[model samples]
Target: MGREFIEIFEEWAKDYDESVAGQDPQYAAVFANYEGILNEVTARSTGTVLEFGVGTGNLSEKLLQAGLDVIGIEPSQAMLDIAKEKHPELTVLEGDFLTYPVSDTPVNTIVSTYAFHHLTDDEKAIAVKQFKEILKENGKIVFGDTMFASEIEKQAMIDSAKEKGFSALAEDLQREYYPIIDTLEDIFTTNGFDIEFKQMNHFVWIITAIKNKE
Candidate 1:
């Protein structure tokens, strides 16, 4: 079930946003926080930005409207199809981060919203290493996703999901495949990212890290 989860998501892409549209304001605010983080990390507004796992162009549109050259990499063609329709001006590629062909032009800033939590521990380490390899000397990375404070908090989240009539359970199940925050920070620190900012909401965490500049 864990390994087959992405396949399930690919199937869900057709109606994913539609099913959650009315219920996603809180999640949307999370993405908004990522936008604010981007603004703080980069003074230049026109440089290239790479967004990994860009689902349905939600954040990509925001970056484009801010006057940045944006490219999106998404593994699911179903999601990319919708993103391309919504944000045709931005370049979008259908590829997974593990083996995706990074842009030849050094990326100035790399941002992902609610996407990194899908990587396994090994994949997370590889992703952090890859992010360092592709970014410019002073490039920044901003990511926003759910974070659990403790095992108790994690269990509380599960119980809350059952109480909420299974609202976000599908998303939660998807996250079970990846490493959450406690381990995520170690991956970033080990791969050359210096933590810049971290904030927590009820159940979500947003973080920004800068690739160390010598």
Candidate 2:
């Protein structure tokens, strides 16, 4: 279901950095938001960090600077290759976050930025369970992406997009291509994880969930 996104991103890899300018008037604001995400992730845990959808090493590069060994799991080889080329020491496996192989070393933290919407809501549930299996007791999982606080809120965003003629995007949002923050919290909290989230803007959110085994 997500392969089409992979193809689009693969072709966009080369110009990805510049492409943001066309879509966003305040392009620098977007990168700044990601930097905020990096700060939050770094402050949350200083253990082994695994980043899913580590596209072009944008977020992973900062993780490395924060002195964490990062294993980046990316679905697009084109994006993977770019991320790898920049951080040769980084271990990047060509894989999807929902089904990436467990890390050989027990991980203490996991982070993903602007990703996860590729998975359906049901798929996200499976992914979080998989995250629990790979993380050590009390390990932290923090991710920043397009997450909504409620179904009504998500629908509102979709409706706004549709009004602007972003029909495909609206359909994607309506269909399970995006995550509802409430649904995600229920999945993790019921399974023994502590959850916290901050909405950065109307369309983006930063969620931090730590495994509470203690």
Candidate 3:
């Protein structure tokens, strides 16, 4: 589970909006075109959506505005608190990608943004497997997060971050478990999904995976 990063998120809850707004110069490139990325994810989602890592309800707000039924799950209580305060009408529960309550309604789409990197590759595989089980026939998963084309590309980005003197950004890259596109494709295909990826920015990619009917 990604609960191990709850404390970090709790601390980040206050300045997260600023960071995503490109106010933090060090991370501006990382969050480039944040609004467009959120809108792209919202555009791909449909029906009842189970959104993991609904940090501060930014994407959730978009889903609601689109008139889709949204169920948000977050691990950090502090983050969840702010999200609830921002959108009182949204139902956000305290949970991570791998540990969340079973939804009462059939899930039509699963979504997340900039948060899935919290899970390691193995954990991501498990989460995808779980998604397959819970999703309705032909359901989908749309996630926008930091991912790389290959391991070499991932290390190159980290090295570049350090060279640019972005210590925090470099450390964040070294710390998190950002997956490679190939690994994600393998995971989704092995679990019966047709997956596609679209680069949203320098760091983020919008991954849309739809379950294949059995």
Candidate 4:
């Protein structure tokens, strides 16, 4: 399922943003929630910012618009191509989040949106460790992605997606990646990050973590 997920997202990269743009109001609200999360964490920009899995540069555009110096790492060439076309001035690289080229100086902030859940357990842990390694002492990481919700809540979201014609992919994801939030939190905490904030919106969980300084 993990490898298949990568293939599916890579294939969908070209039209990812457009498809999302036409999402139902509830799904659109998830993106809005992300904006609020970003605003809260990045109220005062410091140094360089790195984004993992920046598909089509949607969140990257918002970061750029906020006047932050940003670079994005995406494994899918198709996604990077679209991201480059959309934000020609920004630096977008093709690489896996766990093994991507990172600056030696460490970035002040690392952010990812709806991408981490695609990773396998080992990959997810490595990714979190890598984030800790590449973040400055006082740096932070913010992310928004789906998580396990109540059966009722989950079903409501599933039903909503079905009504809006998003069942195929949505159902696939619910089966594949929906219960990793607890593992994600553990990974971050084990690797020197404190889960600072968390919110459950529909079927998604938005989170922010600050790298703990020794």
lDDT of 3 by residue, 77-161 (tens): 8888899999999999878888889755679999999888898989999999999998999999999999999999999999998
Decide which is better by lDDT, 2 or 3: 3
* lDDT tens digits, residue span 56-91, model 1: 777777788778888888887778888888877879
Evaluated against the true structure, the overall lDDT of model 3 is: 0.92
User: Residue 144 of model 2: what lDDT?
Assistant: 80
The per-candidate count of clashes, in order, stands at 0, 0, 0, 0
**Clash pairs (backbone) in predicted model 1:** none
Q: Candidate 2 lDDT, tens digit per residue, 40-154?
A: 7667766888889888887787888878878888889899899989989898987787667664688999888777777776777788888888889889888887777777887
Show where candidate 1 strays beyond 4 Å: 1-4, 24-46, 167-171
Candidate number achieving the greatest lDDT relative to the actual structure:
3
TM-score list, all predictions: 0.81, 0.86, 0.98, 0.81
Once model 1 is optimally superposed onto the true structure by TM-score, how far is the C-alpha of residue 9 displaced, in angstroms? 2.8
lDDT of 4 by residue, 35-147 (tens): 56545545534578998888888788888988899988888777888889999998988676666777678898888777777777787777778788888888988877776
Off by over 4 Å in 2: 1-4, 19-32, 165-176
**What's the ranking of the predictions by lDDT, best on top?**
3, 2, 4, 1
Query: What is the Cα-based lDDT of residue 129 in candidate 2?
Result: 81
Q: Give the TM-score of candidate 4.
A: 0.81
